[model samples]
Target chain A: MKTARVIYEDGKHKWIALVRDPNRPDYLIDSNEYLVIDDDDSLLLDPGGNEVFPAVFSALSTEFDPRKITKLFASHQDPDIISSLALWLEFNPQVKCYISWLWASFVPHFGGNKETFISIPDGGMDIMIGSQRLQAIPAHYLHSSGNFHLYDPKAKILFSGDVGAALLPPGEDDLFFEDFDRHIRHAEGFHRRWMGSDKAKRDWCQRVSQLDIEMMCPQHGAIYRGDQVRRFIDWFSHLEVGIVKG
Target chain B: MATVTQDTGRELRRIVRTNEEIKRVVATAFKINLMAMNAIFLAKRAGQTALGFGVLSNELRRFAMDLQKQMSQLREMTYGSVNTVTALVKQARLNRVLERARKESSGSGRSLIDEFMRTRHNLVFARHREQIAALNRRLSQMIADTAQLVELGSVLARSAKIEAAYGGAFSTSLMQVSSDFERTIGEIQRSLESLTKHQDATL
Candidate 1:
């Protein structure tokens, strides 16, 4: 079964992370799906692939109406990021997908039409959920060439997408990291290879460092809180990515 | 039970594929509507010499409008099927997960899975299946309606061709317009035939 944890909650606005399913097969990579609820309106971030749709849908249905998910934020066009799009749209035909303009055409192959997507430009834009304004911060080349991370100023949460994603081994399913060093170990190899550019990493680090964030949520692994958020930014800045060894 | 799952899976794939095909048909229908307008314009340019052609062209234009309206309705109906079939597929995947969970659990955990399977899972699955069945029936009806509309378009195209032969000095231009009508209507007919085949396979 998947676990849904409320990472941040303030009155009607809440951030719920549907994390870690033990029943998932060993081969399928585990992913985290975030639901940002503002009153009756909600947005689901990187809703995962088709394979994990049942788990994610059932988990979210327990707390929120999957039909009420008015918007979807795809960090990039990876299968694990937005492949469940068709299924989500199936459940709620009115849901509009917010993806980078670069992927507006390509991502629809997973399922959707012209009216279904709200394309965010390369410079990024503000997306409103109820009265709350969430910024789509451009984090291109951290992994996918056309990628953006979502930041909520009021909640001080930066949904980092694949930027801080870690491939944790079996039975290591804590929602938030207790040890920064141990957590960094799980994330190190992923950052070195999956993240394709040194310059992009530096730019992303500099831009996000200015933000007042309490929790940095990633798609694949545990969330970084408080001091670990800064520590992750620093670690990611120095990391030599796009490694092609002979 | 496995056969039912496989059949549902096939039906889901057919729904998605047919939806895409319907989009193409709708585009073609829009084009036919435009072509009909162009034919009326050309018939006016041909003057009194093409009076018979003008009247037939007007009828063809009306036929095109009716076809476009029907195609739009058919497209709208497919959305419901697409939504329901997609939900059915999701439920199937959940069933697999629940079965896996059941094998790994004991006592209360197993009982919980059993209860969910007996109640929520089964109930939701049956509901979705029924929705899909109803949508399929409606889809079949719409396809038949569209096929009949396409047949009417064919007759209008044939009559327009005969009328074009009486255009005297405007005969060549009128013939070209009539040919375009025939070709476009043929395309719509083929699309309908493909939809019928897919609908039959799905059923």
Candidate 2:
């Protein structure tokens, strides 16, 4: 059974990530689900779609009793990112999902009522988990038109959603990338095709570079920790995204 | 699949009912202590003539006290089991809902379909099922202990009856108290036996 692994923790605050299931079928793209626990409340980020609900739900149960999850954050309206909205809402209707105001109406088509969402304006907003504040940084058109990345100032950990994701090869199932140069090859093709604009990628890299981030976490592949955080930013800054290369 | 869910729901309800029954047994156990205390006082009134009966009454009082402590432990365990069952029921319901949704869905929404099937194979329900199994094991052990308590009470009751025969002026009253203790213990034994059997089938 897939269990939650605590990726980061300090006192009452902790970041738990449910890793990709090894037995997951070849056709489906692997995704990671994260739980940010602060005191008594927890916020689930990019909790994945309905298909992975049982796994996600089961992984979450290991760390949290069902009621501990008070909120959810969807990076964009991707089915892989938030399609499990309806299933999660079923488990916890009171859980408020944070998403861009643009997808406020569109994402609910997946599964949400008027009261279920907390719409972040174009500039983005600060979300409170218990007493701790987490900033939602805008990543518009990196892929989705109105996407966001979560930043925890206390942990200096940035949950970049699909921003740093890599499609890892089989047998190399490590959680954190030990070598950044080797890891970028897996992420390069995904960023080129999926990220909609070079301008958006530049804007995101420039903005995130200024933050003192220790670890850059992606939804799909291994995390970039320590100096690799800077290496990823520098590499993404020069990369030509959204272009059809021969 | 629906049948499995229905059976699970029914089993959860049965667990809840069993917890309530165990609570009632604990209350009856409290009453047994009261009866044992009264028997102690009746023996005291017969003075030196009922000294042997008095000794047996003291032993009965200690037995009742020990049984009460064990019953409290059993009640605590039962309450914990109820909570575990409630968690299992929640997981079971989610699984049933996901299965139904998967069948009803189709099309270019291939990711969504994959997600439903993915969740079905995930470890969440399996973990809860494991927890529920552990709870059943603890409950079985608790019920087994209650059975042992009943056997000990029966032996003590027989000893009290033999002592009551030598109680002189308080002989009749002492004999009556011993018989009452024996009957109460029998009722407790029957209730615990029924509980164990009920739990056995569910486990």
Candidate 3:
């Protein structure tokens, strides 16, 4: 049987959670927190953006222990992503919170206790869990104040924040895209509305292109696979760098 | 002109989506500035404000106003002329013809406008430098005044013969306030330098 896709619907909690930089509208960004259960160590990616004590906590409790949550990962230091970090750390004292080096000060700024943080500057860390290895490819500040993307190389799963995540229609709840065009529209609308720096996003797309992606786990919208990710990147590459282009 | 049109068109395209983005950032920064100014005012009203040099609150109030007056002069220089990035870009583009002339001609040391702009820029920089230096001087005077005020307050606090031991206490307190005020000024200067640099770069 296919693995269960545990989802935490943002509903209205996702406002300008990912706002395109005022200077650039083509690059989509905003801090997003997601967790993936990959058989071994429960990998939490960008965990502090949304209030996790209830939604994310209940979602993750299905597979693992909140106390056994050894790894807490984040892309950057925006409050949505890092503010509620203290709340996350309260459940597990041993959870080694990880964030990008560029926003190390950002953690402390959010009252994240200095003792619990581990700095990871660049991407490409083959961090091994029980059996699966997560290849964290660096996705820098494209739209948010600070940002990154985490990928599970083995599962071909890309945990991309604010990338392809779009507001689902009234009653729809499918995370995976069946049609490529539909997914592109969902992704593009958000990107155009809340993008960051085009140059930075172009660099990010180029960097992640090396990875063989199958499923994209975006923070806001549904997931995409294979060629759709490339298509999104292509369309995104043409958008304005800092300002919105009509 | 065609190239300019193309570039401007590209910039206009970039502007559309950034409407939301720009508004939000500008709003946030404005909010922070307002908050900081309000906090400063609230502290002053509460009488919880600490002077740079241990001066009485009223004297320091005057000092702050004086410093503000001096800082306003800085704005005159900053927004006086087109010293922004857009202006610089336009200048560079216009200077291309003059640059070619300099390369081809035997006697093309500098054009009249070139010399004139250079002099004008020097004047701007000189004015800015004076204002910055004058601000620092005013702060120094403020600290001195504060120190004297603190010493006077301390003397009033003492009883009997306020002559012998008071001198020693006054000297120490004076030094402390003066040093603290100077350090505060240094920090202010550093913050201003960085903010001004960012303003210039972004513009």
**Per-prediction TM-score:** 0.61, 0.57, 0.46
lDDT of 2 by residue, A48-95 (tens): 876677667666665776556769999999999998887777556687
Give the TM-score comparing model 1 with the true structure, all chains together.
Answer: 0.61
Tell the DockQ for candidate 2: 0.02
Give the Cα error of residue A10 in candidate 2, in Å: 0.6
Model 1 C-alpha lDDT per residue in residues A1-246, reported as the tens digit of each score: 577788899999999999887778788999999999999999999999877776776677667766588899999999999987876665567889999999999999888899999999999999999899999999998899999999999999999999888988766768877988988999998899899989999999999999999999999888999999999999999889999656
Scored by Cα lDDT, where does model 2 land? 0.82
Please give the TM-score that candidate 3 achieves against the real structure. Answer: 0.46
lDDT of 3 by residue, B18-80 (tens): 233323323333333333343334334434222322223234344444444444443333332
The Cα local distance difference test for each model comes to: 0.86, 0.82, 0.49
Compare the candidates by lDDT and give the number of the best one.
Answer: 1
Off by over 4 Å in 1: B1-5, B8-203
TM-score ranking from best candidate downward: 1, 2, 3
Two-way DockQ contest, 1 vs 3, winner: 1
Q: How accurate is candidate 3 locally (lDDT)?
A: 0.49
Report the C-alpha lDDT of model 3 over A66-147, residue by residue, as the tens digit.
5566777776666556565654554455677777767776676544566777777575465655566676667665566456
Which residue pairs collide, candidate 1? none
Docking class of 2: incorrect
Q: Report lDDT (Cα) of residue B11, candidate 3.
A: 32
How well is each residue in B116-192 modelled by candidate 1, as lDDT tens digits? 66876567877887888888888999999989988988998899899889888888888988898899889888988
Candidate 3 CAPRI grade: incorrect
- Residue A167 of model 1: what lDDT? 87
